[model samples]
Target: MAEALNNLVQLMDPYLLQILVNIGIAIILALGLNIITGITGQLSLGHAAFMSVGAFASAIITIRFNIPFGLNLLLSGLMAAIVGAAIGFPILRLTGDYLAICTLGFAEIVKVVFLNMDITNKALGLTVPTPKSPIPMPIYVWLVAIIAIIFSSFMKDSRFGRALKAIRDDEIAAEAMGINITRYKIESFALGAFMAGVGGGLYAHFINYINPSDFGFLKSVDMLSMVVLGGLGSIAGTVVGASILAAAPEFLRFMSEYRMLVYGGLLVFLMVFRPNGLLGGVNFTDLVLRSLGRKPAIAEVREKQT
Candidate 1:
């Protein structure tokens, strides 16, 4: 299968292939953030911190233990999930701006830690061995992304997912209904961090380098933008949103000096006109069920945000 993919990739333009890789990574990152902020209403500003953890973990594993690519990805995610749960336990109790601030601060601390760490070579960064496989990086990335999307779809209809939505909609009401708010919130954080970690591993392998600065505040914001632009709580919307925003920079490269200015302006324009996001609250799971002649398990969350 990998040999076949590699053969197909050989025929594609490198630039276009790179763009596809970027889009796939962006989709994974956006989906991770959506699990936390969009579905669970946990405003995390340090998601990139988890990504950094994954990047370094995966790189170190390859360098030290020579772990296989597939196993390394899972280990990286597991490491990040552990970190996320540790962080989320006490911090998940906070809401709104407070939670955001704490998460941001945590992200900064992570950046600083990596900057001073010995294994990471401090500011010099670490070189990662790119996976030597018949399967192209983009194929691996998109396969994981598709798996993530499928997992999300299943979670959306599960009893656990309903409990999460309840908490998101009304915390006090959800608690009154006997929901274990803290546990569920922490679970969401862990799951989201796992996805981000896997994405970081893919990114590290693809770029062939890992830097502490690479997964910084701006990167987290970029992921958030994808989730927000696509519509919160909408998996399919996130895929579309991430693809457009991820590819936009490459497409606007001709603008050069004015590229970022144009990108920023476009984002501002989108927010002003479609604040809820392009497909805010439009869940693909609901659409699928409807198409299959089945009633959706829960009412779709409305996009209205006052």
Candidate 2:
């Protein structure tokens, strides 16, 4: 029994490591989507396009120019951010379904362009050259996770994030409060695109391949699902949502054929039962504090005495 237990532990080590990496990527993707759809209330269906742009850009730069991996990732993210901001100019004018359709069309257009672009192999796809003596997958995953956490933390408290929330709550009221709605919208779009790009770069390196087909409308839908499942405005919820959605299928391999159906059914059930999601609008920090039996500052004994 002890020998069997040791064997099981050995077998699980690698898979556990892989799951950690997947969790990091999922968190980055979910958090990025949340900024656009959750905070800014923009239903974008072209996020995969931005991700592809980053993936391809970083892959090409690393392969062709032999640039440092970090610089390549940064440049790729910046390129996607620029594209996102530029696209947001005209598309942001539309609202609701119209906006969604436009974003969907944008993703399709990007895919089509890549499909015909000879530089990207004209529908064949491109192989990313793996880094020489690359960092361990676990380390890379931790780095990305740290990056996502830092970005989320910064945005959660920033003026920009507040502006985004205002826009989401009521665009007209936000504008009335002297917020530059257009600027905030553009900023939100760009920020989301940037994160998506970083995630894409990580994905490309992790997979070591890229193709137009990988960034389809369905990919966008998956991202949207992450945001919705996590709770629209909750960062911690987004992380949980992404982790579960990403890992659920793998854990349910016995029901592989019915996976999509199960996912859809669960989504429907969740929306009907708890429209706000598991955590609703609660932030992760607040959730953790409450879990630890901590009270709000106003309710603390010291504060109350003061």
State which candidate has the highest lDDT. 1
Show where candidate 1 strays beyond 4 Å: 289-306
lDDT, candidate 2, equals 0.83
Model 1: per-residue Cα lDDT over 227-265, one tens digit each: 999988888889889999999999999989999999999
**Candidate 1 lowest-lDDT run of ten:** 297-306
Choose the strongest candidate by TM-score. Answer: 1
- Residue range 58-113, candidate 2, lDDT tens digits: 88887888767777778988999999999998889788999999999999999999
RMSD of each: 3.9, 4.6
lDDT of model 1 at residue 23? Answer: 95
- Please identify model 2 stretches exceeding 4 Å from their true place: 1-13, 288-306
Model 1, residue 131: distance off in Å is: 1.7
Question: Clashes in each model (backbone N, CA, C under 3 Å)?
Answer: 0, 0
